[model samples]
Target: MKPARPWFSAGPTAKRPGWSLAGLPTDLLGRGIRAPEVVERFAYALRLTREVLQVPDDYVACYLPASDTGAVEAALWAMLGQRPVQVVAFENFGLTWAADVRDHLKLDPEVIEAPWGELPDLSRVDPAKDVVFPWNGTTSGVRVPNADFISNEREGLSICDATSAAFAMPLDWPKLDVTTFSFQKALGGEAGIGVAVLSPRAVARLDTYRAPWPIPKVLRLQDGKGFDRALATGTMINTFSVMTIEDWIDALEWAQGIGGLETLIARTDANFAALSDWVERTDWIDFLAVRPEIRSTTSVCLKFTDPRVTGLPAEDQRAFVKRFKDLLEDEGAVFDMEPHRNAPPGLRLWCGCTVERADVEAATPWLDWAFGEALR
Candidate 1:
């Protein structure tokens, strides 16, 4: 059945009711650093995150540029010049990172890839080698096995792109050397800032692995004494978005007040369970991710099954996309259910904690309505 209205779409997901662009503090131009209080507040916020996540004192949390891509690139440039990079690909973003390793970084990477719906084999990972992969493939709604797959005694660093997973799920930091995330995901912070958390091992790797290529201004982590640990608070780079930093602080406060990361995880889990229940009862729809265990709790993906109405014909597929999108938007039930441009045509909904469970419950019927209308 088509949704009576379509109401769910994967990010930039939904905004919190009181979320406002104006709530952000100014001094994003880096002027905030001049004031000790401002800088202290920022650092304190970062410290709070570390405490909440149970990050060891040896681990440092730094504010990278505004985007998660920036954080990932910074870590790669600083820590990758020595080891042979192994990139694991299960979805579009992972493939993109792998490409960056090849074309931009110009490193010949050993790539282990799986199709969109599947996950890369964790057993194939050699803990002795440097590895890079996304924790959650937001576009495809597939998640990799946690850091438990990587042995603690591995020789190389494990860099994780967890933009969509941070705050929404638990990250096994003991097994992760370098983890990067954007504020936009579960935090619901505006775009432009990325958070990079690194363990002592990761810092050591950066200090030892001097890049063959010239490190750009933003990516370099060393300053004479080798990888300066202090850079984690000040961020080795220049010019930060103070406003974005404060936005992250606000998100962090909300997280703590609402029972922290565990609460957020439960919310997402509940949303996914709700969505899963609905999917089970629906005949025409099925999950793209074959294994329920690996399915992403944050991004719930689906496809229509009633081929009798809109299948087998390419024209019908195109029509289904248009009608489903239009129906959801028109009814205010959901937005942005269309598949990623690069992925198979299917629906992807963000069941993140920032979104209300009531909204998801309210949206299921809209999905049925949308399907019914499209089929008609």
Candidate 2:
């Protein structure tokens, strides 16, 4: 039987169990975000975020406009020109950032790229130059295995896009200068807002260095000379949705109630383990990420390795995926399990903390059924 709710989408993922509109603070609905009541709630949300993520004491967590993309672009536009940049691109989002630096920023960055399901060689990264890479590749299901590759004695900063890995995986705060994620990812909160955590070094860069290009008002994190400290205190650059703020707070509270980050990680580990056990027994499918250490626990990408399926043309393979996914959806067994268009034709199921282990266990048999049906 299908779970009560079938939501395995990657972004804007399933909300916390037992979530409802009634739980939101209705009194704060009509009030302005800058109003005292709403501001206090927003501030509390930031505090909860810090506590839940266990961010460092010197780090500043700020709410920014747009989802992870906004926070990422703001950091790039504000801080890329300080030194030579090394960009690691393995998947779509990372490639997008590289394109921004090469085409939009018009900077001659040294870009290192790897094919899908693999990571760039981290040992070759130049620590003397500023570096940007996604800690976890949501599209490819590969992640940086560890932060040991980063040099402690480096002169330049490390800017990490950790949208999918923020709450699910452990982050090395000391190794990262700038890290960005959205409430919509692992937290399963409402979208439209991003959270940027900056270290003291990143703040100093903002205070001392300026990008050569023009900075828009919305993306500016500093005044003429000094960093805008208010942005870290729930003061957004543009108008934001108060309801979304409330939902984020609710999600944080739910995380706390469920034993904080450790519990969340454990939940995801169990879900991934369940799927891995199923995959080990199932011969037709296998992990897209070739290396076990780099495989993502949250966004689990699987590829069809069955000779019958692999023998088909590219278009037929895509058709197989569509048919398989459609059959699952039609049975109300699952939804939003389709791989990204640019990704290989397969399945990408979100195994984040919001997902239950039992659901993953139950869904495996359904996946087998769908695959068998599609083959027929």
Top model number, TM-score: 2
199-316: candidate 2 lDDT, tens digit per residue: 9989999999878889888788887666789988877788888889889989999999999999999988998999899989999999989999999999889999999999999999
Q: Which stretches of candidate 1 lie over 4 Å from their true place?
A: 1-9, 17-33, 234-236, 308-319
Q: What number of backbone clashes does candidate 1 have, counting pairs of residues 3 or more apart or in separate chains?
A: 25
Alpha carbon deviation, residue 220, candidate 1 (Å): 2.3
lDDT of 1: 0.78
- Per residue, candidate 1 scores C-alpha lDDT tens digits across 195-285 of 7899988888766667778878777677776776666775426666677678777777777888887888998889888888888998878
Q: By lDDT, who's the top model here?
A: 2
Candidate 1 lands at a TM-score of: 0.91
RMSD of 2: 1.0
Q: After superposition, how far is residue 313 of candidate 2 from its true place, in Å?
A: 1.9
| Angstrom error at residue 356, model 1 | 1.1
Every candidate's lDDT = 0.78, 0.91
| Span of 10 residues, lowest total lDDT, candidate 2 | 218-227
- Residue pairs in clash, model 2: none
**What is the Å distance of residue 122 in model 1 from its true position?**
1.6
Collision count of model 2 = 0
Score residue 226 of candidate 2 by CA lDDT. 62
